[model samples]
Target: MVDQSHSFYLTSSLQQKLSKLVLAAFCLFTLYFWPQRFELWLIQVVIAVAICSYFSYTIYRLKSYKSSFTLHSRNLFKFANNPNEFECKVLWVSPLLCAFYVLPNTEVEDQAGKSQLIIVWRDMLSDSNFRHLSRLLLYIRRNQASG
Candidate 1:
């Protein structure tokens, strides 16, 4: 039985990071660049409050939970193929809608001969979130080949 455990890291490209920074700067520029727009200042205040509240909630939930909620794949081999199979499990911070997901090795094949065991975190949170997760999964698959 081959027991291989790996931590998949989601790495962003330099271009991606630069684009994010640019977008953030643009938002900040719009918010603070103009000092005379009283209405715009009020809107910016509301936006800041909303952003703070969201982060506070996310942090609180992360700290308060004993362990992350997990969801196992019904059919592990539906995504991969192997002669000897293993079981995969996903640890998630949120129930169904979140960006953070962790996959840990569970069990390797003993005497039973299986093809492949796969545990996948399906982030069907939203179109954009799901797209991000899908990209992560692709990276994991590519890294698995090299590792």
Candidate 2:
């Protein structure tokens, strides 16, 4: 199904692929530095393995976060599985990539909105949807600037 101008869905495969790429890079880095120093190399390998395990676990936990998102008027957005809507503010923008991260419109802030960081990577979205979302995000930014 086609998403509206204000709505977009994230592809799980893309997310998983990106995560795998990162994990693979870490693995490759460790392998590339393989040395004959058994003691030191073992310690380095253990540390690298630990870091990769932690990162994989974090990604698994974040799987619970909603994958679908819709932008409502007045800078409000709600996740598909979530009913409540929260006001959002643009945290960063990349005109070239039509990508950005949004934060909750609140006084207190953390890593991201209650769950995950709202980052839309170019590859995560289709060209048309990305263009529409880019325009919508621009509109939201303008409202923020004017008010």
Top lDDT hit: 2
- Cα lDDT of model 2 by residue, 1-147, tens digit: 122337788764455557566876767576666676867787877777877777677667656644788886567777777666666666666643443444554654543456335767666677787777777777778888989
- lDDT score of residue 17 within candidate 1: 36
Go through the candidates in order and give each one's C-alpha lDDT: 0.39, 0.66
Superposed Cα RMSD, model 2:
5.7
Please tell me which predicted candidate would have the highest TM-score against the true structure: 2
